[model samples]
Target: MEGYGPAEIEKLLPAFRAGEAGEAKPPTPEQDLLGGPATTPENYTLQLSQAQAASPVHQDATHAPPFLIMHGTGDTMVPETQSVALHSQLVHLGRQSTLILIEGFGHGFLNPGNVTELGPGVRLDNGRLEREPHTGFTAQQSPENPFELEGLAADHEMIKQFFNLHLG
Candidate 1:
């Protein structure tokens, strides 16, 4: 249960369900400013072809438990299209899933509006990222801030409700 296999995912399920884990750290300005390498159309096509070739299809027809797939709209690292594609596949397979796209959010939920003073030396920005001056967590722009984009918390809540209805 170390990699991206079923066993690993199963082992993490308890913490995930309890909402005690899965919180991703925010990208620093340096990390955010660095753009991806340029890709030509041909290279893109080739990558897509390779991915399609390696992709696996779920063949099981049995009903699956409800799923909540949330993706950040501003996620430059992982395109939102990936979540859309997964949601589409789930729907095609007659599974129950809900996809929530949070606007202004990036790969992580860290946003300026979500910042809150945690303690004397700790601060949490947008519930998506934490800042500890001693630990090198500095003030920076985050995708989790509602002021960065409207309805972020609401969207998150919607996803929460979806999980509650299906999983609970």
Candidate 2:
């Protein structure tokens, strides 16, 4: 209740208390090893609290080491703002930090078979993002527009350079 908002605490407190009292059902054999649905109030609160505890944004960053943060502008899984916030925090604390946003790419772009789809607000062409409020598309890699493939190679080189500069 202390860590959560009034509305969320109202919903979660009942379930959390029920779970503490052993009113929640144990996992059945048919259920996955990870347990029940993610939306379950007890599990949701636990997971959210754990994630918050582990989040770097909430940690003390004073005198932290240099950082090279990279994120995809089109990523759907993790918001790019997290990287921006971390970088800003590091810079504000007087630590060296660089933030790079890869345009027209989604989460796991370095991995194979991950399709990059632009949302309605933007469009992707030749690894570049274009402003097209009504247009959205899936990226296609060709000889002329080998965005993801070239991006992976470039990212590897950038990582190598960062390590050489920071750790060498």
Candidate 3:
């Protein structure tokens, strides 16, 4: 949902009169929808057409289905703020929502070509991350840090737990 088929899609696309923010007036009809004002020209015309039907954020979240949001703070394709906004809205409406932000990951984090440091020279192997020892990365993957590849495993575990909790 951070970058795809969610109600907030219009906000991330370059379309005319595309979408709305929480309780926000849709962009003027002449403006094109954008992730934010920075995503496009300042003079583009836009609006959140059929916003209520397009994005769930426009609807009441008091009765929304359980939600588990996983986003990467380093995502360049879609900012983590979008997840932040949706989660905030759900909380504000007293709905069940959880947001897990993997700090150093990006939108394509799972891609083999988008790899990053796991522990100094260490990296994920066979679905696990190994430290190179005597490296600065050892400190980077500490338990308190949810920004490392290990955090991704924790995130997956949490997702599984979230589903079990909600589904049962």
lDDT tens per residue, model 2, 87-111: 6666667766666666645555444
Residue 11 in candidate 1, Cα distance off native in Å: 27
- Can you write out model 1's per-residue Cα lDDT over 29-98, one digit (the tens) per residue? 2222222111344443444444344432333424655545555565554556666665566667766655
Clashing pairs in 2: none
Question: How should the candidates be ordered by lDDT, best one leading?
Answer: 3, 2, 1
Model 3 worst lDDT run, 10 consecutive residues: 133-142
Q: Estimate the TM-score for candidate 1.
A: 0.41
Clashing pairs in model 1, backbone N/Cα/C closer than 3 A: 110-143, 110-144, 111-142, 111-143, 111-144, 111-145, 113-145, 114-126, 115-125, 115-126
Once fitted onto the true fold, the runs of candidate 3 whose alpha carbons sit more than 4 angstroms away are 1-7, 14-47, 50-53, 108-153
- Model 2, which residues run further than 4 Å from truth? 1-46, 112-154
Better of 1 and 3 by lDDT: 3
Compose the digit string of candidate 3's lDDT tens values, residues 1-168.
222124454465444333333335443312233333322233233334433345656677777776666555555555676677777777777666656666455554433443554444333222121221111211111122222234334334445555666676
TM-score of each: 0.41, 0.50, 0.50
Tell me model 1's lDDT, rounded to 2 decimals: 0.39
